[model samples]
Target: MKLDLIEPNAHYDMAHGKPAVLEYDNDGSWLYRLNIEPEMGIPEGQQEETQIGWKCYEVRGYNKATKENVKKVVIRSVIDETAEFDLVNSYNKHVLGIAVNESAVEEYKEYLQFTEDLDAVLIEDLSN
Candidate 1:
């Protein structure tokens, strides 16, 4: 599958806890696994905003078929989209056993679902 075909926010199975592998290609030459990764951090120029964080949705290509490998190197490309810092920080805080407001929780949930949907579309496109 072409890495550029992946959308900005791909939908995935949240119930599964992690983004599912969208595609795997082994054509005797190389192995490729495509999937979305949600990461937390402030972007380079936005580092001064301490209360803010970002949930970066990246389409990562791995050399291995599974993520269980000790050194999972990305061999293809990474397409990323950055969201509001508060939304990501809320999600991160919740994961880190911190308390967030009700609205923050809902916002983060919505963001996650949106990204998952994006993934679902990419997976379908690759299959076709």
Candidate 2:
């Protein structure tokens, strides 16, 4: 399938953890993976922050009018809107992680800021 990014080069962080590590490749591109846990999925209560994910996706359908595959990338703060902000939730999806187009790095970073804002708003509620 053909793919394109609305926001390509943004950097993001997990509120409970450190920022996502961006690895640069010789080809001048970057990538990051969303890991669930070291072992069993449970809170370790460690000082180190885990970088949860805010995945971007593309939805596709057959366009009868154009006889082409209609595609759309879904950019969201998290996979689920009503679902609580949890690492597990982010982990299940985006397992393959995200690869950014060098040109879109700035937009990619800005797009990822949603996590920072979301975590700030839910901090108190999450503490309970």
Clash numbers, per candidate = 9, 11
For candidate 2, write residues 7-115 as lDDT tens digits. Answer: 3344333444432323335554433322222222224676654444333321222222111111011223224443333433344334435532443444334435644
| Model 2 TM-score, 2 decimals | 0.21
- For model 1, residues 79-111, the per-residue Cα lDDT tens digits are 123445666777778777786567777777775
Q: For each candidate in the order shown, give its overall lDDT on alpha carbons.
A: 0.45, 0.33
Cα RMSD for candidates in order: 16.2, 19.9
**Number of the top TM-score candidate:** 1
Off by over 4 Å in 2: 1-103
Candidate 1 differs from the real structure by a C-alpha RMSD in angstroms, to one decimal, of 16.2
Measured on C-alpha atoms, candidate 2 has an lDDT of 0.33
Give the Å shift of residue 8 in candidate 2.
26
Flag regions of model 1 displaced more than 4 Å: 1-82, 94-99
